[model samples]
Target: MAEDLSAEIGPDRSLLLVDDDEAFVKRLAKAMEKRGFLPETAESVAAGKAIAQSRPPAYAVVDLRLEDGNGLDVVEALRERRPDCRIVVLTGYGAIATAVAAVKIGATDYLSKPADANEVTNALLSRGELLPEPPENPMSADRVRWEHIQRVYEMCDRNVSETARRLNMHRRTLQRILAKRSPK
Candidate 1:
């Protein structure tokens, strides 16, 4: 009789971590390993897709952006490859439009960037549409405005001048806003 290699971890504890940020991937992978998950990582959608084809993960944590393409591509592929895979989309550029699109494509949940590993594990394991409670102290209006400006700046491909123009704010003012630390 052949011994099952998967016995070391629970059968469904395998995971895929897809993100272009190497540091984030490393940290999350280690944390997931400590949580009994065997996490395999890929920095691009193509690589993630190949990994899924060879061995579908039981859970996945994907970044919204990647070096090669959007992470939604990977989420869709994972869903197609294995309907049971639970997926969470993480983005530093969180916005309602993309979050809705991600869920529509089969992600289990959507989370903003800087989320810790514990939060991710909870998200992956939790069932149904219920989400963790929101942070007691949410972002201030100024912080929200800053984040929205930053999101637009990023979408404009980091064209600061263009972002300032789009936001109908002066260039120097935009720079000042970008330079300041986010409010608590």
Candidate 2:
């Protein structure tokens, strides 16, 4: 379901964006502004917290890793200060463990980095809403890792050598990993 933010910010919203990546943050802030959000950028968790405390925003988008501290810390602080605000996390490596940890620590939602403007906006809009039921057992760590490897392999067009090179793994090791994941 889409978020009903009309009551919060009167059809226009303000946001706090926390990330150490200057380029990415700048680009995303501009994109969000075009989407009707006023985005305030912070390069670290401390700065993000300070900004939110001094001028509480309607929502927040935080990166998982920062130069000073983890984004989860910022999310926690935001939740404490503004219980009604939505918090979305961004992860670059897309680790399932980290995503789960973020959610446990008060993040409203999470999206892997390189996400486009639409994806980010949608995640923000749907924040704090119950997600659809996950598949049985869902995906485990090994399954996620295997899927990452498979995606990298396909991006390299199934060239094991290129895939391994891109992933910083030995060709033979990559072969072994893929072979081990093959069903009997």
Candidate 3:
């Protein structure tokens, strides 16, 4: 991890990290502090929006979904309060449409979930002149689909019928997919 990212830290080192996963956000906040940020954490969309509105941060890492609502709501509030805020939207349920929506709503970048502190930092510091290098081993299409289905299944409380209905998939087909191990 690169130290002394003070150059990238805006007028203030204030950073907001919002995610529903308490452990993950806590760990990421500590990692960011070591990299020279003053991170404030929030575990829900309402809390995140309140923090962003009360005091817009110089940089933000927001989750795409929260217990209360979407993380994009917080992103929008921050952008409205501070036009120059560098915001990154993180999502466990990664999809091209959501990525585009995040960017369209003023997010600086969109990252899939399980992103490391370094990856988030790089995203915050990116100038957009150069494209990021492609992943050494990107997920295969089948793997991506499987991941999506699994995420939806979890989101639907592991109710196969609800998950299948939400995914527009037949219940039996969804069951078959759920029964198998994840593709690499």
- lDDT, candidates in the order shown: 0.83, 0.78, 0.87
| Residue pairs in clash, model 3 | none
Residue 65 of candidate 3: its Cα lDDT? 81
CA lDDT, candidate 2, residue 23? 97
Candidate 2 regions exceeding 4 Å error are 1-12, 127-184
Report the candidate with higher TM-score, 1 versus 3: 3
> Taking the tens digit of each residue's C-alpha lDDT, what string does model 2 give over 1-184?
2343345344548899999999999998888877778789999989999987888787899997789967888888888888877788996756555566678777878888778777888777774567666767767677777767867775675588999999999999999986662221
Q: In lDDT terms, how accurate is model 1?
A: 0.83
Candidate 1 vs 3: which has more lDDT: 3
Looking at model 2, the pairs that clash are none
Q: Give the candidates in order of TM-score, highest first.
A: 3, 1, 2
Q: Write the per-residue lDDT of candidate 1 for residues 11-57, one digit (tens) a residue.
A: 77889999999999999988888777889999999999998888999
TM-score of each: 0.70, 0.66, 0.75
Best by TM-score: 3
Instruction: Mark the 10 consecutive residues where model 3 has the least summed lDDT.
Output: 149-158
